[model samples]
Target: MTKTSAVFPQPAPGSKPTPRVYTDEQKSMIEELRQYALSLLLPETDSYHPNERRWIEEPECPARYMRAAKWKLDDGKRRIKGTIEWRREYKPDLISAEHVKIENDSGKILLNGFDYDGRPIITMRVGRQNTQPSERQILHLIFCLERAIDYMPEGQDSMLILVDYKSATLKSNPSISTALKVLHILQDHYVERLGRAIVTNLPMLLNFFFKGIGPFLDPVTREKMKFNPNLHELIPDEHLEVDFGGKFDYEFDPDSYWEQICRHAGVNADGSRFEPEWKRTQMPQQEQEESPKPVDSETSSTAPDLVADDDDVESSRAPSVQLPRASKPVSVKGGSSGKEGVEVIGEEEPNVLVASA
Candidate 1:
């Protein structure tokens, strides 16, 4: 099937980026939220809730909450207070690699790459999921979400989510309950943090999956969802994965990638936090020339017979679904040191294959 391109007007080259100008009323609401946050008495111990106070007092965080509450001071205060209490229970910041290592075994969720707007990208490959539906899976997701939020640089408040359903069938889709839980967490605590969500290679059968979670999604979150758009326009070729028709050919290595994530989080094997070297280490580097030519959106084409087979021994038993045929064939490569490779088969189906490094 031909992929349709979604055109977002790109800012003119070298144009001065617009700055956020808030009105006086909004400013007052933000200040009120900040004051409310400051008045709370959190535990002095940082281990259980590291950076708790600082996060509440973060200059941009209160504004984000206020905007999420539609600038209503009371509503925003309730949201802020609720989130503070929820963090104490959820401990998203304290979720460690050891706590969710098993969930990472299949490399299902990854925090890598950036979008054209420089928002950090979190790619979730549902077909690669190895575990049954459980609360641990949610913890794993919260861990990755925290890491993504921490990776955000100044001036960037949102993240880009790429949910790839390449080898996914109806059986592999997340349960409605789990989906609703995810929706609640994202829409509530992580308010206004989704820059955009691009759901690619989605199977028709999985349309019901979205329909199941549709009602719980905030209208704004629903609007951020994009389906099978030309990803090249949204992500730079260097950062885009080859699995999604870009130059970055990243294979998933569960072991090494997990270590990379742990090191970034500065957590010990037992789930305790430690001071990392703070070196310039990053997610697996993209191995390409200093500057690679970007793919021309107008001239780009995909393999007509390109297909991803559910070759995972664990997920092989789950039946696959027939997928729309593409225009060009993509060569799949396996990774070294526990990196799982993608095996492209005939034009049978496109399942959940995450294109992340």
Candidate 2:
């Protein structure tokens, strides 16, 4: 197994440095989970190729699953299993930014420059944008996470996410279930990926979502979370988006980003609209990024399409989280399968899954 520094210097100059590397026992568990997860995620279809099989073995990939599992084989196994199920259902790698692109959502969730640690700066305008349905929004977020992960080099395996809260309201706040799931995925699946989560211009109504979210955060991530009333403190000017008090005028361009993602995912855009090309690298390609195009009037994914009734859904057998749209006290709906009722549990924290249905 390889090692990289995933922790950052604390805001307190005298604070002790934290542990970021996986221990030997954890490493062993990671290897085990990797072997098992590979079996689950890799389909014996015609699409399977020798080089394609190498993705799960990428240096940091397995280790991430272990850390999310907190070094427990059982936990790691479940995380991998659940991820495999989600992957099949959402088919994330096949999902191109072009296919889910919202012209207006470009700024709502834009990646501008690199941070001091050299991680990409991803600033999301939660107050202004609603790009996709809760589930698709989560999927798009996963896509962004994929891009962020692909581009990061070994030592700098993270990104700085600034959730802009300028004009936030209760209605605008994403459903608690989706927010929890997204945060859970980030902490668990990505491992040491959030360098800083600067939440600027917070609204009072947004407090409930944050409160429910408090229990799920990783210690390191929780420590890194800050309410930056002013973005100038944590985010550098070059990496900061103009709307969020930074110099850069960043916008999300599906075409450009999709091209980059295609190359990263080893795919291409041909006569088929989106073609899977084997030439893409699993990691970030060292290329110059051009300025993204301007955003438009497109609407984001609505809650009805993705936000699920999480209250009735237990957190134990959560093979797949039902992402129904945002509403108060969700109505009774069919279980995950709609026929055979599967007991679902959301043991999502620091990104670990306890079991699968």
TM-score of every candidate relative to the true structure: 0.71, 0.60
lDDT of 2 at 130: 48
lDDT of 2 by residue, 1-357 (tens): 122112111111111123356568767777887788667655555342222254566776666666556667787787767655554444444444453444223345554455544566666766655443434455556666665655464455567676677775555566666666676666655665666666666666656567776777666666666664345444455344566655544444544444434343333222011212322223344442221121111342312244422111122111211122212221211111000111122222222111000
Off by more than 4 A, model 1: 1-19, 43-50, 279-357
Worst 10 residues of 1 by lDDT: 336-345
Worst 10 residues of 2 by lDDT: 333-342
Q: 90-111 in candidate 1: lDDT tens per residue?
A: 5566554565677777767877
What local distance difference test score does each model get? 0.58, 0.47
How does candidate 2 fare on TM-score? 0.60
Q: Cα-based RMSD of the predictions, in order? A: 16.1, 15.3
